[model samples]
Target: MKPTLAPFPATRLRRTRRTPGLRDLVRETTLTPGDFIWPVFVRDGEGIEEPVASMPGVMRRSVDKVVEAAVEAHALGIPAICLFPYTDPSKRTEDCAEAWNPNNLSNTATRAIKAAVPDIAVMTDVALDPYSDTGHDGFIENGEIVNDRTVEALVKQAMSQAEAGADIIGPSDMMDGRIGAMRTALEQGGFRNVLLLSYAAKYASAFYGPFRDAVGASGALKGDKKTYQMDPANSDEAMRLIERDLSEGADMIMVKPGMPYLDICRRAKDMFGAPTFAYQVSGEYAMLAGAAQNGWIDGDRSMLESLMAFKRAGCDGVLTYFAPAAAKLLNG
Candidate 1:
């Protein structure tokens, strides 16, 4: 129902805004630690935490350090942490077989986190770019990103994550029919409880540059990902993709590079009424944090406001690098 207000001073529209306590009473949107899915970078080592040059305040931690980070994040009430590995250049291959290796960086990190912080959900990124010589999510054959072949590889990769006890399998590959294929594999492979958070409406945007650098794909990428990732101009296409993914057994759906695509996020939620999420991609984090460091924006306030915007836009949760900071502030 639409809120009806008095025509004159009787309404006193400023009454709620005049005080923080009153404003909290009337607040329509709220953000909490549980609303975040923190994304962390994993390197291969012990006790190492290398700063990501592109994303300020973000670090690529070794497996043991990642386990420590997971414990810290869970203690802050953040329910989930997503893993992206900084694959060694030597491991990048045409077949991307490293992606499915049972003891690769991502799998090892998953197992470590699950063992250390079993209550906090461990989400794994299922993409080939981190392990691909071409640095594309899908495999290339004769100068083309072949969809079917990539989907097959993605199934194998997801199964490995499941085997490692990943709570959520995030298929960010954007390959056609990969969700259904992975879903079938998960069910048949005896891991039916694993959640499928499909990156159904991921756009191939300039916002992914920092992410590529964080995962060490920037130097290896041979061509643009425009062929597989959705075009930035299409809105209707996003709806179709989300609908199809849900039909294919996606338990949840996500819109990537979030701030720019909140409209897609809103539409996806309103259209499908599923648990919708947005990824505040690395470039978005860099721009905001970078400006804050330069004294252009109030860092803490800006971060909180930006995260609250996701809740207002109808997202059930968001994947962000600012999880711990935001959780700390909100917990206060």
Candidate 2:
């Protein structure tokens, strides 16, 4: 493609910007409900929807309330909903056995949503953070985060969610062989149709601070996730991880903490040409929300602009807490 000079005289960029209708006609990137995946936090209770302090408008809903939320999101035209849990402290364990419990917070929520709002796709986070007493995404042994053993547990966790009617199984643990292992188990267990949206390029970054708070993992976290999650300074390594996940049968790939990793999102999309998604993690939400709360930024305008950047960077969709707000604005 060669660059061409615009026709002169009437050749002003202002011509296209002359009116609201004209600007709408020339708009290049667009956002829609189909481009969103709503991530909601679930807690134990009934008729509950409690907001996270760090995330102004986001809530931790109970199972029954999660069903209601899913119905509302579907009516708003959102494509899917992802689940994260705020486990009871008593339920948390060093071995994270509750991670695969059929009646666990996430699994229970998944079953409720599938039964109540069967049309909305249900995506569950397949990591041990919320269940682990150590607040790590995987198993910890003798003060070290282990890999192979964690993958074994992750497989069981994935199967439980699948059996509970989850439409998509998202492996956010970043364990090397978990994707392939989960894929094989799902097939053997008669869930061959369940989608695997692997968190392929998740980075160990401070951006996840608010997320830790949302899931009640902040106080329990023993150490940083650097040993397992990718480093923020590497890009080539992200591509390698994305490639490996795809080869291992990942149906979709995600880059966490969306805005800071838009470059990685672009690279992953270009290199793999797969269904690439980005997580607009909680800290990013809190920063924007906090600034808006203090009159530092126009929250509404900035919110839409930030999400639009994801599409411009080649993300197929975004996992965001801003889904309902953005959907309402888009609908308007």
Cα lDDT of model 1 by residue, 268-318, tens digit = 989999999999999999999999989999999999999999999999999
Report how far residue 197 has shifted in candidate 2, in Å: 0.4
Cα RMSD (angstroms) for every candidate in the order listed? 3.2, 3.2
Candidate 2 lDDT by residue in tens digits, 132-214: 88899998778888999999999999999999999999999998899999999999999989999999999998988888898
lDDT of each: 0.94, 0.93
Scored against the true structure, residue 274 in model 2 reaches a CA lDDT of: 99
Top model number, lDDT: 1
> TM-scores of the models, in the given order?
0.97, 0.95
Top candidate (TM-score): 1
Kindly report the root-mean-square deviation of model 1 from the true structure over all alpha carbons.
3.2
Stretches of candidate 2 off by over 4 Å are: 1-11
**Which pairs clash (backbone N, Cα, C closer than 3 Å) in model 2?**
none
